[model samples]
Target chain A: MPQTLDRRRLLATAALGGVVGATGLGSLAPEAAFAAEPAAVEPGAPDPNFVEGRISKISGHLLLVTGSDTVLHSIRITDGTSIWKLHPTTFDQVAIGDGLYARGVRLPDGTLAADSVWVNIVNLHAHIAAVGRNLLHLDHKGQRIVAHVVPGRSAAVYNGTPAISDLSLLRVGRHVQVLGAWHPDTNEIDIATVYAAA
Target chain B: MAAIRGEVSWFCCGTAWGPCGTAGGGACGTCRSGNYQHAWPNTSDACYAITHPDTCGLSMSRRTCGFRHYTTNLCNGSRVGTTIADCGPQTDLFCGERTCCGSACGSNRIIDLTPAAFSAIGSLSVGLRPCSVDTV
Candidate 1:
């Protein structure tokens, strides 16, 4: 409770550097930030640096997660933890029953000091059934997915190249892996990054 | 066989969300989205006809369902063990595609993992990573 008050006070007084920006937000993306940190666990084993499951409970900055095999985990979200739902958001935006995958350092007390959390994030591989202006009609497996390209924010990486915003290279009948945030209970998604054939 | 150098991505199988709802238990019939399973491009003749990895000059021996293969994300040291549960990745569509991390690089789509299997090695959002597929 006291910590909450202190955080609120800081938020009210501090000049926020994070803005609803006009450029690529990859630098602020949690996954990229955490991706460099090598996993301390054994290969093919559960990575201590990552967590995945449904939200069982949220208490202040702590989140209780029921992972696979009903393994329960506690996640401590600090100010440093970048939470990306569809886009970068705050701690309050998280709600119960929402699925999440988190990457961070595991504290000695069995709590994960989260560096980042992706809520309802999905990665999909599909073919470009069609393409409209800033819109992509995806055929994932055999199902259709309507992926919206968020202007300025949405970018594409062609065959491991540096990301670029110009999607004119996106042609029909091409395969692509889309990185985006899923719309709750819907088939639509807001694209953040697209990895595609050049 | 030696580890095949290639790129890897993930797919949904079994009962899943959104467009993945239509995804059944894959070609193996034992596939599940939550299991450490994968889709191979060379599962059968018909499957090969669809994926056509050979069009890229990559020849793979026939591997049946339930065959175990290990995939290592070349970007990181993380690896995962999965069984063949489906046929996919339509390799010919993007024959010369490649992805790399630092000095290590891989080309062509050789493997497709289930969501459960993929999240084990790398974040789902960073799709299409360089990888090595092996049997051990």
Candidate 2:
């Protein structure tokens, strides 16, 4: 397994090198030397336990949502349901207009009895325009976004390597992807992880 | 048969924190935020029923645990292959949602990758990117 991983990493590195060379993005550097093997699946099926959308209405423990596809979903929150809004929170923390992704069981009435819910989670690909004491200026497409680095929460993965809490390896002018919780009504995000080439 | 084109996003699992504390390793039980893994919309019959890609005119093949799919960021052509660690992206939920870069555009949310996997191809803060999913 280790040998296979090494070979894969080497190939990935070569591929990355080719890309950087072609694009002249000299600042993009490889940070790790390992790549994971792909896993398999059956094909042509759907997952029945997950839901994602914006909270259109919240009444008691039930949430009325309008999916990105315009599908309507009724999600039920139970005592065992875990709701997250930037962190582990309660049902009360969920509000209208908040985006949500839920994983749980679908009841007979079509309501998703959620087991876990993540609110305002966003994953974006952007260029690291600048780096500050504890924040990063990112340019996604044409929009400038501010990503706050939470010391204990923020992590980085360089060149397909294990995640670490270090942010020093990150460089400005390099392209990076950020996984974070969106701060509602703002262009700022609380970063959970920064995927960079190092 | 061919590549599946759509938008890609990221999610957390395993050592969950804050809002992810209750995320518990995904529906497949092996999902972790640090691993090179991803969530597919079709891992089982039950899962398929929820994320029915067919609802949006997409005919996704049902793939179970450990199924590998290569996701390529359409913008930069950067690609990463990952195994299915859980079920996700609720394809129908975000059916018409689109992500784009330059002139390249991808619509719908088809896959949710782990931090380890997503970072391999693109930055996570950009929220979403147009991508192509293939089995190679």
Candidate 3:
């Protein structure tokens, strides 16, 4: 936790310098900056171990994740752990408006890594493969995926698709994407984009 | 100009015996392999021959980034990446023997924008020439 916090602070300081645009202060040229633009490097392949999912439920510290293959993830967020040097909070302190990027491990109890957590402030893209009563099961590739919609955020459904008796709509074959954080434990992602992919 | 190159075959800290010659192999922690090993882009190094005629060096690692690329060493039979540091000798933290600094491995290649500029139609696209090479 302390290490994450320190990295975040350092990244924040670097960002501040970047925004200021001072020449001698490591001003990143536009071309160079574009080249270094951060992109998600999917750790490993489509293994459930290194999957990045959305938070569907947060019961205490456990995050039930429901995307990129249905799997319950055990997440642990501590003070100062940051991604890309950004400090985003987890735990009960986290809410619906978040995203999660995690590195998985096979714990002795058949759970996953309690380490390497990233709560994204921005939503991501995923293809919805299934939908259920107040719950949408998604798929990225052949993986079975799912998401839980918050009440006020329910409008996120494509054209406000109701979440009841829509099991038919949640077909075995469909494409839908989502954007949100994966709870540290449980590994459920908050729904951000429940739309079609082009 | 002598076009030289060097490469770090593999680097990982694990109990595995023998070189996997690739990162992330043999349960090693977050092993990095490939050409994109340097943290900074557009960096370059000179390659040279090792002072000693014998000895294969250790697999080099980079703190700034992940992965290593290789080329054939001019003096030794070892194949290394085409970087200035790879051609030379001795030992140190970043590079030893014919190995080169991983930071300058991939970036040494000349920047090519012919495909990008030629995307447009008409003679205007053909006239697009790079003003100069800049390092990052």
**Top candidate (TM-score):** 1
lDDT per residue as tens, model 2, B36-122? 688998899999988898887888888888888888887777677778888887677555666667778887778998755665555
**lDDT per residue as tens, model 1, A22-41:** 12223334334333433333
Chain A TM-scores of all predicted models: 0.70, 0.69, 0.35
Q: List model 2 lDDT by residue over A58-171, tens digit each.
A: 887689987654778888775545556655677777878787776555666677766456688766656889899999998874678889999898888664345799989889
DockQ of 1: 0.19
Predictions in order: lDDT: 0.74, 0.67, 0.30
Tens-place lDDT per residue, model 3, A33-116, is 212222222322133333344567776545666432344455533222223212234354555424444432344544443324
- Looking at model 3 chain B, which ten-residue stretch has the lowest summed lDDT? B114-123
Which has the better lDDT: candidate 1, or candidate 3? 1
Task: Count residue pairs with overlapping backbones in model 2.
Answer: 45
What lDDT tens digits, residue by residue, belong to model 1 across residues B26-54? 88887766667889999999999999999
